[model samples]
Target: MSGPLRLIELRPSPNNIKVRLGLRLKGCEFETIPVALDDAERAEVLRLSGQPLTPVLLDGDLPVWDSAAILRHLDTIAPHEPIFFGRTRERIHEVERWERWARGVVYDTFTIVPGMAFRGAFDPAEVERANAEMRRHTARIEEALADRDYLLGDAPTAADLTLVPMVFSTMLTEEQAAASRIAAFLRQHFHLGEERDRTRAWVERLMAHWH
Candidate 1:
């Protein structure tokens, strides 16, 4: 645990970006080992974490898979810094709910919808239907930010970290960064622009963790 931690991740994975941002926000120094989307890399991931997934964090020989688990582990490893999880029972439940929604519904849409549409693998009407679902999720987030700076309150939390990476600038490539339909959707719903939108401002605050 005294040694620097290692994270095996895919470059474009929102989940991986989430863990990286979480660690950076806590001022933790760690090495990132990128795993490409290939059979060999997946096998290596399985060997490391018993799962064919990126963003597997290793502390010595112990492998912790999944971003949320890694964040919780980091909190234990460094307790004096900013905490991502909640301190109270009700607050913890609230944080957990938003984290699940962000990862499951919101971020998952970004992961799947664009690629499916790009490949023309999905039916046109089906893509439209999927975009509608994405809109609903984004709308929920916008509504949540209507009254506060962060999702749960005025301060950043695990839920905010979980969701912010989905909209982070480096989450996508430069050519398609502002060109993707999902990117437009983010600008419309997430208010991801240079404007003074509170949620966008919150995202900027978290960006200080980069580098």
Candidate 2:
């Protein structure tokens, strides 16, 4: 009778996972339109959103693209259970700081590994370079998780959800996500727990509806 909240997701992309995690957190149900993300579909998405990126959320006439923007949009619809903020502003800042580090350094470094590993045409030297970059970031994260149960505090936050796709996918081939401190952090804190259920459900739902 009614259309699902249309969410366009690009497969094989951590950016798409970011919004999927966000929507799962909000408990927002949506119809996913799986976009192939090949040259043709990428151009189509670019024409629609003015960029060739993944995880574009379109509700009625409103268009929300980018993982961060989608997350923010969800927050507006459901603010009581805030993902980015907590009881205090400091808490929000802390989450933002870690989230920035995740995407900027950790995810940026570790994100490329799985793609290279899975792609048939990948160069061995490039994969080695990616692994080295990821190892360095993993060590950093392992140190960060030495004491904290999660990235922000005892509870998982926006930062944790955002970081999961990249970290989890990196270890998709049964390898450790990172090295030294950051690797330990991912294994101990990120590998399991509630977020896993949420993310799994999201992917399953997408598969069922988006296809």
Candidate 3:
């Protein structure tokens, strides 16, 4: 790369967190440009990536948008600590499958309650439904972790980085909640509770290891 990497992001977003964690894990030094949810900021994103997305990574003159793409770029540039867990074809496929599930199924279910809360249209019944769905997804994660320490065995991969932040959002500490209302709202409405002991412990373990 010709210059320092710049990550344009919304700090609390799980996708942004994923890319940030990937960068940190790879020992890549980068600047974080925090963006807000406003038209001007969105337009700036559009100007850079031709899309209105917060997690656009400026790799010198090249603009890489999307969290997965950014992580891939990081792996290419800094391959010492591979986010996709090395270049074995089968391992790469497995990691990509987990990433797909995390982004599509897990994040889709997880975002519903927060989306509603952020819109100022809180519905108790709808929130409950969304919470139940999140729990179901968490249960899947719990089961996935039953056999291994991390999602794909001993080490944290892109899969773990992608998924854990979204799950961790629900079980924020007092400090995290105090710092962000969105965290506070997620903790209040989407907490996994003691029923997801394994998942909660896994999240705590990963957060301690990575964050």
Q: Judging by TM-score against the true structure, name the best candidate.
A: 3
Off by over 4 Å in 2: 1-4, 39-50, 85-87, 111-125, 146-149, 173-211
Off by over 4 Å in 1: 39-41, 115-122, 167-196, 207-211
Predictions in order: lDDT: 0.69, 0.60, 0.81
Higher-ranked by lDDT: 1 or 2: 1
lDDT of 3 by residue, 1-211 (tens): 6578999888878888888878877878888777885446487788777898869999888999988888888878887755555589999999999988998998887888779767878888877887788788888888888888888887778899899998987788888888666778877788776688878888887677444
Tell me the tens digit of each residue's lDDT in model 2 across 107-156: 66664444443353446575567666655655555555556655555555
> For each candidate, what TM-score against the reference?
0.76, 0.68, 0.90
179, model 3: CA deviation in Å? 2.7
lDDT of 1 by residue, 44-100 (tens): 788888988778888878899878898888878877546778777888899999988
Clashes of 3: 0
- The candidate maximizing lDDT is 3
When summed lDDT is taken over every stretch of 10 residues in candidate 1, the lowest stretch is 187-196
Candidate 3 achieves a global lDDT of 0.81
| Residue pairs with backbone atoms closer than 3 Å in model 2 (clashes) | 138-182, 138-183, 139-182, 141-182, 142-181, 142-182, 143-181
**Local error of candidate 3 at residue 33 (angstroms):** 1.1
